[model samples]
Target: MLYNAVSTLGLSKRLQTANTELQLERLRNNDEIASGKHFDVAKALGARTGQAIALRNLYDETDQTLKSTALLQGRLGTMDSALTNILSAGQDVLAAASVGLGQPSPTGSSLQVRARAMLEQVVGMLNASSGNGYLFGGVEVKTAPMRAVQGDESGLPSPIQIVQDAIAAATGGTSSPQTPAETAAAVAALDDLFATPSASPLGFEGGFYQGAPSTAPRLSARLDRTTEIPYGIQGNDPAMRDLLQGLYMLASVDTSQLPLDAYKPYMEAAVAKVSGGIEGVRDATAQLGIHRAQLDDIAAMNTTQLRILNDQLDAMESVDPAEASLRMNQLEVQIEATAAATARIARMSLTNYL
Candidate 1:
């Protein structure tokens, strides 16, 4: 078959262009070695590198979150243990008080002293600091949750008096110690205490102390953080209130004057209430442990997921040096041969034979 020379030349030129493009594509995709001024190489590397960078960032963020959760779980666990100890101490005091009240000679005076000490220890635990700040003072990190002032021999302040005074001052009228006559009157008084705007120095109003006052003098008895959930138990809570009231009543009672029969119920009631409080604390501690365990499980799962994702990313983007080296050598030889062929082809001309 007769072939056209112009067509043949065009075909040769097209074949050369196609071969050059194929070589460039292979080099770009392989990315075995850093190539200078190759657009295809940059494009290929940019795509794969971007994916790797994104994966790495995701891994890093997951790791950080896992670490933070771990820290929170650990803190919670420590706080739980402290609460358990405080509960135990409170129980011991109540038991001692109960036994003492039953006896005629009342071996209970020593028990009272021990109970007072334990209560003080409980206070210290509630104010326990986690190095960052107090754990139990709610958001008030700098201040202790409970304090015993010297006003009375009692280690705790008169909460009822404080509330009453604050309410009276806010209302500008004395509250009836007896019944309020109507629910509306009582609600109105409460509204007055709570409705005072935050702009007023008293804070969110409601006669409630949000956090320990910064300027308020420190209490002689502070809650211990090392042995209790700092501020886990509130003074106003019924269990604590009953326990304190019982203790105060016991302290005031003249055993010589009062018959054992009259005091028996008081001792029994105090024991029951205090025991209940201890159980409450134990239950709370157990719940915290459960929460901590859940957090640990979540962290472990996240870690495992991250590891798998990292491995997948590595497989997709990472190069094997040995395989890359072999491919690179083959491409180099092919490129050299292509160059030599092109040079030889270019020198050939019809005029040389004519």
Candidate 2:
């Protein structure tokens, strides 16, 4: 038989290609074992490659959004907890103030001292912050929501200062008391100031909040492509305003300092105001509870979506170790056999046989 040189060379080249393919198969199997993912994504994905990639991108974006919402939820949650504590403190102040109505001890007494401490706690909570941001500062996250300093200056509209001045005028505590007409005029002035704003303290003519008088903006988070929800409140809700007014009213009116006969009307009004404040705080806290519940729901949905998306992605991208190993072994054996055939053919020369 005639030895066709061209055919022999072609056969050798084919064997070399097969050997390279075998080495690549072995490397791929090793990668699959180490990474648990397919080494040949294009081949594994086949006709659905574009669809699978799009789905993966969507999953990643949604996951990122979910993580951000979770962080927001945490901030809101911290604010909610602080508010809850303040609500309890407000209630405690009311309960203490309501004790022994006519027989109460004088200023610096147990009940009055406890009321002052509780007022301090409420102020601290209003000024509370979390994660480097003011929880109740609305869009002004970096600034504290309330000014907590005490002021006795005349005509100062700061809520605490107003409360302080009123009580001082009524009882000769810091300032001298006024006569019937003068005292009536002072009470009317306070009544006009509080009632003018009517809706919220933010609406008050003189700034009730130390921060900017801008209405607190609600914080919003996207849950999905078409769903966005607002989940934040501020220090200036009507309910919060009512609570502060109630607390400060009680704090200012030291029943012991005032003449019980003359200040009977003032003391009775303070008690009524605080009682209403307690209910207002509960209402505000309940509203926060609803927001938290919604947040929990969003978190649950996010978790479920991640689980399903990850499972789907894994099914498309993961390789089975046993199957990859068997294929690798088959290629290795074929490469060895092909190498032996090519070497044997190269050595068979016409002259050597003769």
* Candidate number achieving the greatest TM-score relative to the actual structure: 2
Per-residue lDDT of 67 in model 2: 88
Note the Cα lDDT for every prediction shown. 0.52, 0.66
- Tens digit of lDDT per residue, candidate 2, span 165-184? 65465445544223444334
Q: Give per-residue CA lDDT, model 1, range 219-273, as digits (tens).
A: 2211111212222433333343334333433332333333455345435544565
Q: After superposition, how far is residue 311 of candidate 2 from its true place, in Å?
A: 2.2
Report how far residue 180 has shifted in candidate 1, in Å.
26
Q: Can you give the TM-score per candidate against the true fold?
A: 0.54, 0.77
* lDDT, model 1, position 315: 68
